[model samples]
Structure formats: structure tokens, C-alpha cells
Target: MTKKKQNIIFLLVVLLFTVVLIFIPTGFENPSLHKNTERVKAVITAVNNSDLQNHGIVTTGTQNLKINILAGMHKGDTISATNVLMGQKRIDKIFAIGDKVLAIVKTDNQKILTARAEDYYRISIEWILLAVFALFLIGFAGITGFKALLSFIFTALTLWKILLPLILKGFSPIVSAFAIIVLCTTVIIILINGFSKKGLVALVGSISGVGITCCLALLFAHFFRIPGTVQDFSETLLYVGYTHLDLPSIFIACIFIAAAGAVMDVAMDISAAQNEIIDHNPSITTKALIRSGFNVAYPVIGTMTTTLLFAYSGSFMFVFMVFMAKGTPLNIIVNTNYVAAEILRTLVGSFGLVLVAPITAIVGGFIYVRNY
Candidate 1:
């Protein structure tokens, strides 16, 4: 089949697969939480903050709000709602008049009983941002940009539909994560680069890097005594009746998944560079192309290895602040469970990133030059 025809056919198949994934049931639900509760978009008509106390960033007590349901069975109905603040600056919010909110209302016999403000109504704004992004992407890169957007959607859906559900269903998290990541990487590369030798080269190299990262995470996480509970909400999940979830294995899966993007970047870099070299000099030997791939990879890997550091450090900055604020010793801080986990995350991920460069270069050498 023609290359363009092949790409079109593949795209249709993938689009169908994504549609199916969207409707597949996750098979898990919070029965206690959603019982008899319906959410509605509301505009706060009035607020009574007389019962609330403010201490700079931290606020305690409650905001009693009058909200008008916007688009539901109770549309045009104004109801009293409570917005509670627990003094946790991070998660607590104080609502005010004229603010759009999502209020979960309890109903009996088609009459609203009570409403609780869940969060700000940002879904509309979120869509606006996404629309702008999609326009700019397609405007700049045309078909390639559209394909990139499709790949992005595929990745998000795979994680939400496949990975999360499988793990929640008590599947082996490490294997589930790896299988999902590999499938994502393959589809993403194929979508962006087409189904060709270069795409295959990239996929192999990326999966190789992911494998290395997973193994290293398994080893070093154990060595560093990093606990899976270091991840946020892990304890909450266990307490919420997923007590059998393998937290440590999930942590290992997380390590590779985090690194997989950078690994793919490196692999694609080498594959694309090698592809260009082979295209320009079709007679180039495999040995010369390998060297060319390595040359391109040298600078790319250097920056990428550091990118992993900055990314992890930025994510872990809150932990750093907490330790420094408490005047914790550097030694004690580094040995802390969460801190150590971050360290293991960065190092193992970087190792995979570094390794993928050579792996991609070698793979590309054989794949690209074999055509000559």
C-alpha cells in the first residue's frame, strides 16, 4: 500500500480504538460518595462569611452561599450551600458572591435538600484553553500537528481507561504499566512519524529505555528504602478499601512511566537524525551512520539528562521547602522517605534516558543503513 494510504488507514483504526476505549467501563465507583447526589453548575448569588476566620493563606470555618443552579433539572432554583474551609491552605477554598461553582445537591422527591460547593466551575475555561491550544497547534504544523494532538488524546485515554482501571482491578501494576506504556509509545511514534523503519527504531529504543528504568527502580527503590506510601493518596487508597493494592510495585511502574517520555524523545531524536543521514547519503555505511547518530545524541542526551533533574526537582520543591523550613539536617532530609523516593526517581529515569541514546543510535544504525 502507498505510504499515505497506509497512514490514513492506520489513523482510522486508531481513532476507532480510542472511541471504544472511551466507553469502556472502569468498573469502579465511589458508592458512598455519589449516593443520591447530583452536581449542577451554579452561580453564587450571595455569601455569608461571618462564620469564617482568615489567617493569611489559611482560612477556617465556613462560607454559607446562596447558589442558583444553572443547567440542571433544578435550573433557576436558588438554594443554600456550604463551603467549608479546614485551614488547609492547599485544599481549602473560600467561595464568594458572583463566583461559578459546582455544587453537589442532595434531592428527595425532586426537591433539593442540601448543597455543598465542591469546587470552582472551571470546566468551561478549561475547554477554552484546550480549544486555543488545538487551534494554535493545527495552525502551525497542519496535518502533523493534528496527528500530534491525536497522539496526545490517545495517551490520556490509555492512562485513564486502560492503566488506571487495570491497576484498580488488582492486576500486577508493574506489568500493566509497562504494557500500557509500550502500547502508548508505539502508537504515538507511529502516529507522529508514520509506520516505517524509523518509527520502529524509535519504538524499540524507547521500550528498551523504559525496561532499564523499571529494573533500576526496582533495585534502587529497595536499596534506598523508599516506601510506596511516599506517593500522595496511596494511604488514602488503602484506607478506602483497596488494601490489597501493591503500592511498591506501583511505585516502580511510576518510575518508568515518568521517564518514558524523555526516553521516547531521545529515541526519536536518534532515529530521525539517522534517517536524515541515510537519506542524504544512501551509500553511508552502518558504522558511519552509527557514529553520526551518536554525535547527534551527545548534546541531546546532555540536556535531556538535566531536564529530568529540573523536572523532578520542581515537582519535589514542596518537600524541599518543608524540610528547610523545619531546619532539618541535609542528611536527614535526603534520607526522608519521600525525598529518597524522588532521588531514586530522578536517578533511575536519567539512567534510562542516558541509555536510550546509545540504544537508539545502535538500532538506527542497523535499520537506516540496511536500506543502502
Candidate 2:
């Protein structure tokens, strides 16, 4: 078949696969054993502060809230809900009349026992924000932007549906993560650059860089002696009955997965530059094209290395501030497990960025320069 026909077929296959993924269940639904609990949206009709009181060192209070259920089986029914305040501002919320909120209703033997206020109803706003993002993405980039959005959706579904479920099923985290990264890199690069020499070079370079980063992460993590529990919620996973997981392996997997995006970026940069060089001078030698790719990659590597540092450090800015406030020594802070983990993450990812340039340049030279 012709190239145009092949493109159309590829697009159709992608769309079909995406649709199927959308409906596939990840087996994590309704894993909660609490069958009597139901979450519903409700609007506060009235608030009664009759139970408000101070009890010695702590203030114990309850707000009697009249609410009309907006959803679920009891929709349109008005019920009495209790908002408990334990004097902790972080967990306590005071509901006002006419406010929409989420509530957990407990029922036993088909009789409603009680309802508790959970939080403010914010799903509407979340959907609105998502819509705005989709609109702007498609509006700006047109067809390519639409494909990028699809790739985003595909990546999310693959992670949430396939990757997470596989890990939960006791698959090796390192192997699973590597497979997902390769899949994502292939689809994303092909979507952006099409099924050409450019995409192939980028894919090869990206996978090679990711492989190197993964190996380095494992090596450094082992030598550094940082446990997987250094990551947030990692310990929680063990508490929740996933004690079989290898936390250190998972943490090592995350390091390279985080760096995969930057690796792909460097690969694409080199590939695109090489493609352009070949287009301009069809007779250019492989050596000359490789040098051109290096020239394009050097400046990009500088900013990308710092980009990884900033991206990783920005998340822990508050932690850094707290350490400084307590007059902690820089050596102590750097040696901490959490700090060391971030250091590994940033440096390993930067290494991927640095290495992907030369790898992509070499691959691009072989692919783009046909006379080599």
C-alpha cells in the first residue's frame, strides 16, 4: 500500500487501541471492604451550632447540618448530617448553608445510620479545567496537538490500567517500568515524527539512554544504601498489605522513568537536526552529519541537565527550607536518605540527557546519511 494509506491505518489502530484501553478495568475498583459506605453529593440546607463547646485543652464541637442529597440512591431526600470538629483545622471543615459538599452515608440493614461531611464538591471544577486544557492543546497545535493529547491519554491509561495492575500482580517493577517506558517512547515519537528514519533514530537513542540510566540508578542506589521507603507513600504500601514488594527496585525503576522524558527530548532534538541537515545537503558525509548533530546537542544538554535539577528540587523546596531553618549542616542534609534519593534522581536523569545526545547523533548519522 501507499504511504498515505499506511498512515491512515496506523491512526485507526491507535484510536481502536485507545478506545479499548478506556473501558478495560484495572481490578482495583471497589477493593475496599466497606460495603455499607456510600459517597454522595449533598447541599447543606442549614447548619446548627448547638453542640459547639470547649473542653479544657481541646475544643470539641459538632455542626448539625441539614442536607439534601444531590446524587446516589437517596437523591432528592433531605437528611440530617453531622460535621464533627476535633479542634484540628487541617482535618476539620465547617459547612455553611447552601454549600455543596461530599458526604459519606453509612447504612446497615437497609436503614440509614449516619452521614458525615467529607469535603467540598470539586469534581465540576476539575472537569472544567480538563476541558480548558484539551481545548487549548488542540487549538494551538492543530492535528499534531490532537495526536499529542491522545498520546497523553494513552500514557496515563497504560500506567494506570496496565503498568500498575501488573506491578500489583507481583511483576518485577524494573522490568514492567522498562517495558512501559519503551512503549511510551515509541508511540510518542512515532506520533510526533511519523514512521520515518527520524523516529527510528530517536526511539533507538531514547531506549538506549533509558537503559543506561536504569542500570546506573540500580548501581548507585545499591551503593548509596538508600531504602525504597525514602519515597513518599512507599511505606504506606507495605502497611496496606503489599509487603511483598521490593521497594528499592521500585525506587530504582522510578529514577529512570522520571528521566525518560528528558532522554526522549534529547534524542528527538538530535534526530530532527540530523534530518534537516540531510534535507539541506543530500550529499553530506556521515561524519559531517554526526558533527552537526553534536553541535545541536551540546547547548541543549546544558539547559536540560539544569532542567532536571530544578524539576526534582522544586518539589522538596519546603523540606529544604525546614532543614535550613533548623540550622542543619549541608553535609548532613545531603547525606539524608530523602535528599540522597533526590540527588540520585536528578543526576541519573541528567546523565541520560547527556548520554542520549551522543547516542542519537551517532544513530542519526547512520540513518540519515545514506552514503555512509
Candidate 3:
């Protein structure tokens, strides 16, 4: 088949998969839970904070709001809504008059009963931010940026539509995650690099590195005695009746899944570099090509080695701050599951990054240089 024909077919398959995912039912969101509630956009006309009380920096109690509905069946209706505070600043919101809010209006037979100021109506701003990002990407990188956006959407849909659903359906989290990674890795590399040696080498090397990371995570997690409950909200899943889940396995899956992107990046870098070298100098021996690939990889691996640490540490910075504020001992902190889990994530992810470089280089030497 022609290369152009292959690209057309690949895009069509991706589009079909995306459409299917959009309409796929995971059986979890059976809207009966919120059948009587309708989300509406509204402006807070007035806020009565008389019932609210201050306890330290956190506020607890409720603010009664008079909201003028701007959309939905309740349009033009003025209703009273409650914004409750639970003394947790992180999850709490304080709204002033004239602020736009998302109002959850409860109704039976189209008659309004109660309303809640659920949160700010920030969806508009979120869409605007996304539009800005899309514009910048396409404007700068043109066709390649557009392809990257499609891959980004595909990855997100696969995680939400396929990966999480399978895990929730009692499938093994480790297997479910790996399958999604492979699916994502294949489509993304192929879509960007097309049906060629570059894509093939990158895909193979990326998966290999991810596999190594998964093994290390599971093996070290056992030695580290990570109960998996250490992951944020993992225990909450058990409380909410997903007792069938193996949290430790899911935690292990998360380590490699997080690392897979970095692995793919390194692999693609080496593969693309080797392919360019071989194209420029066809007589370049596989050994010389391998040396050149390694030279290209060394600088990338240096920067990438600390990339996971920065990303993982940023997510848990507040937790680290809390520990510091409490003056926790370094020995105790290191032994704690929180720090241990972060250690596992950083090290395993970095290991995958390091492994992918040489794997891609060695694989690329034979595949691209020798046309194997």
C-alpha cells in the first residue's frame, strides 16, 4: 500500500475510535442519581453571610444566596441557594454578589424546590484557556501541533473511556493500564511518525522501557511494603464500595503509566536522530550510528533523569511542607509511606527514562541504519 493511503486509513480509524468513545456507556454514570437536579448558570444577586462563622483561617457554616438563573428551564427565575462551608479551605468557596455561579436546582415535575451554589461558573474560562493553548500550538508547530492535539485527546479518552472503566469493572488494574499504554503508545507514535522505521523503533523501545518500570515498581513496592492505601484517595475507593480493587496493583500501574510518556519521548528522540543520520549518510555503519544515537541521548537523559523528581515533588509539595512545619524527623519521614511512594514514583519513572534511551539507540541502529 502507498504511504499516503496508509496515513488516510490510520486517521479514519482514529476518528472512528474517538466517536465510539464519545458515546460509549461505562454503566457507572446512570444519571438517575441526579435525575431531579439540573445544573444552571446564574448570577448571585445577593449573599447573606449571617449564618457563616469564622474559626481560625477557615470559615464554617453557610451563605444564603439569591441567584438569578440565566439558563436552562429555570431561566428568568430568581431562587434562593445555599453555599455550605465545611471548615476545609481547600474545598470551600466564598462567593460575593454579582459573581457567576453554577447553581444546582432541584425540581420535581419542573417545579423548583431547593437550589445550591455548587461552585463558580468557570467552565467558560476553562474553554477560553484551552482555545488559547490550541491556537498557540497550531500557530507555532502547524500540522505537527495539530497531530499532537489529536494524540492528547486520544490519550485522555482512552484513559477515561477504556482504562478506568475496565478497572472499575473488576479487571486487573495492572493489565488494564498496560493495555491502555500500549494502545496509546502505538496510535500516538504511528500517527506522528507514520508507518515507518522511526515509529516502529520508538514504539518497541517505549513499551520495553515501560515494561521494565512496571516490573521494578511491583518488585520494589513489595520490598518497600507500600500498602497502596498511601496513594491519595485510594482508601476512599474502598469506603465507597470498590473493595474488589487491588489498590497496591493499581499503585504499581500508576508508576509505569506516569513514566511511559517520558520513555516514549526518549525513544522517539533517539529513533528520529538515528533515522536522520542514516538518511544523510546511508553508508554509516550500524555501530557508528549507535554511537551517534548514544551521543544524542546523553544530554537528553541528563535533563530527563530529574524530570520525574520535579514533577512528582511538585504534586506533593504541600505535604512535604506540612511535614517540615511539624518538624518531623528525616528518618521517620523517609520511612513514611507518603515519602516512600514518592520515591518509588520518581526512581521508577527515571529508570524508565534512562532505559528507553539505550534501548531505542540499540534498536534504531539495526532498524534504521541497517534497514532490518
Give me the candidate number with maximum TM-score.
Answer: 3
Candidate 1: pairs in clash: none
After superposition, which runs of candidate 3 have C-alpha atoms over 4 Å from their true positions? none
Summarize candidate 3's per-residue lDDT along 1-372 as a digit string, tens digits.
999799879977997898788898877896876798899899999999999999889899999999999999889999999999999988899999999999999999999999999999999999899899988998999977877877888898899988998898899999999989999999999888889999999999999999999998988989998887988799899999999999889999999999999899999989998898888899988899889999999999999999999999989999899999999998999889879989989998998899889988998888876544
| lDDT by residue (tens digit), candidate 2, 1-372 | 876676667767777888999998999887564688779899999999889887675656998999999998888989999988889865778789989999899888757899988889998899899889999999999988888888888888898899889888889999999999999888888877778898899999999999999989988888999899999889999999999998899899899989998899889988988888888899999999999989999999989999999998899999999999999999999999999999999998898899989989988998887787
Of candidates 2 and 1, the better by lDDT = 1
Sorted by TM-score (best first), the order is 3, 1, 2
lDDT per model vs. reference: 0.90, 0.89, 0.91
Please provide, for model 1 over 1-372, each residue's C-alpha lDDT reduced to its tens digit, 9 standing for 90 to 100: 899899899898889998887887767756877667788899999999999987886789989999999988899999899999989878888887889998999988878888999999999999999999999999999999988888888899999988998998899999999999999998999999898999999999999999999999988878887678989999999998999999999998999999999899999989998998888899998889988989999999889999889999988888899888999999998887888888888889999999999999998888877643
Question: Which has the higher lDDT value, candidate number 1 or candidate number 3?
Answer: 3
TM-score for each candidate, following the candidate numbering: 0.96, 0.91, 0.97
- Angstrom error at residue 358, model 1: 0.7
* Window of ten residues with lowest summed lDDT in model 3: 363-372
**Index of the highest-lDDT prediction:** 3
Angstrom error at residue 43, model 3: 1.6
lDDT of 1 at 220: 85
